[model samples]
Target: MTRSPGAGLHLHLDPLGGAAGDMFVAAMLDAFPELEPRVMADVIAILPPEAGQAELSRGQSGGLAVRRFALLPNRRGEEAKPRGHQHEHDHGHGHGHHHHATTYHALRTRIETAPLSQGTAAAAAAILHHIALAEAHVHDMPLDEVHFHELADWDALMDVTAAGSICAALEGATWSLTPLPLGGGLVRTAHGALPVPTPATARILQGYEWHDDGIGGERVTPTGAAILAHVTGGTAGTRRGGRLRAVGMGAGTRDLDDRPNILRVTAFAASSGAGADRIVQLACDLDDMTGEEIAAAADALRAHPGVADLVLVSLLGKKGRPATRMELMVYPAAEAAVAAAIFDLTSSLGLRRTELDRLILPRSATISVEGIRVKRADRPSGATAKAESDDLVHAPTLRARRQLAHRTETG
Candidate 1:
């Protein structure tokens, strides 16, 4: 689908309620129709040995016809080992040490060399790196040297690569996510029994907002955390003004009583005239400053180069004393400059700053300079000219600089 220049895209991640890689890949496929076959091949190739014989099938669940890749652990001529003794006594387990690094590296190589877009490859690499880094930190080893026992499993490799491919396909879109659900309970892994949302998962969830649903089991895995962390910018909340286009649900391996074990992802298209908009909100209150100084400070703040919007209000403070409230909205990258300007131009001791999501219209502006018209070009509607000045004033836009170079070449 062709999107306008300022279109907004929304992506939602259902962490605690979904399957690991399967849910992620399914959601992406729902958004991009062309990713199905490539993802299926990756999934089939990476089926972990522990999963036994893996097969892909189509089925309907929750009124949606979807692809279900089911993996059955090899059971022929083998009996289930006792829970506690399985690790040490089972001869079929093969290697004493898990070759996680070798498996992950091989999978990564396959993904990197796959017939995929550049964006897809880079995104897949990033997800793998996140998983590897978490494992490395947990084992107290360098990221490149540490092995990923669980994540390196074939299933994980397929899921992550498919996800990367989907993300790469949507190159120019922005992703917004909802709050993640972190299910409650304990989970068993190679590292022994640990609380649900293990240390690695916790690290990934550190700055994000999440709620615990009292369900027992591993709701979110390291692979799931890695994928969410790589895509969702570690922030969660609602977005307004975007129209929901498509939604996909991916089911988990196990069933739960409270809710269906599934992940839901939704895609959105921004309303017309909506462009990329971000605002930095700055606020400070002071009771000591005189009215004159307060007015001066407000004027200076408005004059600052980076300040886009500014506000000042008077309010009653503690003990019925009057205080001035100063607030400013500016571009995200210009936050530091706005803050510096406030400090230099005001008498408040400290300021509070926050980043806000905003929608802006597409815009362009022009400036005039005194220079010779070295080059001229005629468009279907209007004529454009490029000029050069011997004295350097300010660096021109890249387009302007390119035009100047073209003029020089022709001359």
Candidate 2:
């Protein structure tokens, strides 16, 4: 296994209730509790010029007090806070740089110019890309025209950028999450009223486990989904006898009589033994399926959060019957849901599955080259950087920047 200073730190996310951006950052703070000042400082230093000042608060969620941050934007000389995912995000902010709806490219440019760590920038860009791609599909518009909408606010940006910095602050610590709960019911948005787990949220969280908790209003926000996508390394399943370090509980503003309506996270000491990391691979054969059905099946497979890779092959089966084989490489926690999807969507009754071990480097870093943010993975051999496709479009000279990225990747 690749070693590092924070090698033994592991996090278990119990998002069974629901998830949100503020909830995640708050829960993490609940773990460190004392790191609130430092994390907020880093976030403030990088707050966008168009955004306003942020104020933090300590409050109770289900009787457990937590640290939460709120953005105070000067709207007509009147400060405003988010109201249950309700914000007046018009194309015209009537002040500063937000004169019109910020397009994907423009925001990409803004992120490129911001003074932030490479990993922080790249993580933010990647999360935005996830939302952009999904929004493009949901709105059936060109990716370039798809503006940030409700996602363009200062709070949303802070939510994403803050998440990036916090993950980096953890050093080599690894992040894993449990199945997510899709809060059921209707919710308002920039694009009119939509279902809970909004189209973009559903799109970004295609492959994760979700269920209705019978709560009205949105439980999971796009920022929350983006945070999970930005930091989480899919499903890490259950930790076997790892030491519990800290438990953080973040409560949502809405009070539900049935439950506490909180998001709790458990911090654990990373396993120091063999078989610490393993993934599940499932394979099934398909013969009696239509082309349209096959296409939809492939889309469903690709959207799942736990799947690492998926492959489809055509071949001749018994009695020379033409058939196709579906091979899926998914995280161990996704086996059941993936199998259920396969059976429900295709003509498959049984599946072949196997678990394999993997060694992961403890460190996560980012490097910016020519104003382009790239996610860096450190290996013993060296480091490799990956630019988010959504924001990489801003890079004018990819060839030269790629070389610079490589050279700068060296610590």
Candidate 3:
């Protein structure tokens, strides 16, 4: 049987050892091994000129083997050496980088210049933006003034970018995350000692549920928190239920006594009775369009054969300019056509699209008053029936149609 467009993909994350950029990326790769070439290539292609190659391998934690990611940069210690050589760095920093620390501004520029797909680049920048914001606030400095320092290293950068690329790889899947584990005791930071979860990590993880598992050490790092904050939109899932499609275990560098330092990623398929379906929203900011122009565009789109619906909202776009954001939804099969139509109808050269799971009422049908035999859907007091609205041209009156519908329902 054919399925409707609403049947979409859902992703659930189990950050057992708390989420970090590498763990998140590694876990996702573990879940979808086929993505290694495509995902990793983009990371390598877009990295700063100074970065080396990225290496993903299997590692064990708490006796469980999991996917571990590291950056094997081109530069080396005194001499260029083979990959997998352990270098000096802190816990938050992944693998090792021989490059100098970059400022938040320079990092942002580097990401923008990278030749990445639309989705991957935006996601990468967004994850970094969270880190930058948190760091700026923690130091009470301007955003541009904030130096990435530990966060700017190749491993951290790769982790951050890989996290974004992972999200891009899971393009059509809705993302949901479990609450992070807040490890007990103090954690060492570049500045000094701080409570577990680290202040910057805590700041970026606002709105997410957290609980310390009574273990001693730092579970969530700023890089991890920033990735979660950006990827999950700062919201953690209370519960997600569906048929499992895939699962990946990402191993953290260190080992834990009780729990495996692994992040588990699971994919779920869309199901019925929950009123949930897969959805993709395409939006573009229209700063130059007049009210009439916007309305005309909407009218044209609403009439498109593939478009499901559209909404024009007033908002502030780049540089505080007044803009109208035109958001539209369509069936998965219609996505490409709809995007092409938007380009022809508006001034937007590019549009943003996000795949999501949307809950809709459990019902079915069609309606057409002009048809010789129209089809309409009606649920009266828990009972469902296909109703035919009044047709003065064909039917005698409204009451007569209801009587006919009642007889059909009773039968």
Q: Which candidate is the best by lDDT?
A: 3
In model 1, the runs with Cα more than 4 Å from the true position are 1-8, 41-67, 70-107, 114-118, 237-240, 272-282, 285-357, 360-411
Return whichever of 2 and 3 wins on lDDT: 3
Clashing pairs in 1: 46-154, 52-74
lDDT (C-alpha) at residue 224 in model 3: 80
| Residues 81-185, model 2: lDDT tens digits | 333334221111112233335688876666556777535566566666766777799999998888776555566667666676666566455566666666666
Which candidate, 2 or 3, would have the higher TM-score against the true structure? 2
Which 10 successive residues of model 3 have the least lDDT summed? 367-376
Please tell me which predicted candidate would have the highest TM-score against the true structure: 2
Q: Provide the overall lDDT of each model, using Cα atoms, as 2-decimal numbers.
A: 0.57, 0.63, 0.66
The whole-model C-alpha lDDT of candidate 1 against the native structure comes to 0.57
Model 3 residue 63 CA deviation in Å:
2.9
TM-score computed on alpha carbons, candidate 3? 0.61
Q: Residue by residue across 45-73, what tens digits does model 3's lDDT show?
A: 66655556788998787887788887765
Candidates 1 and 3 compared by TM-score, better number: 3
Answer with 1 or 2, whichever has the higher lDDT. 2
Cα RMSD (Å) per model?
Answer: 12.5, 6.0, 19.4
- Residue ranges of candidate 3 with Cα displaced over 4 Å: 1-7, 48-50, 73-90, 93-98, 272-411
* Alpha-carbon lDDT of model 2: 0.63
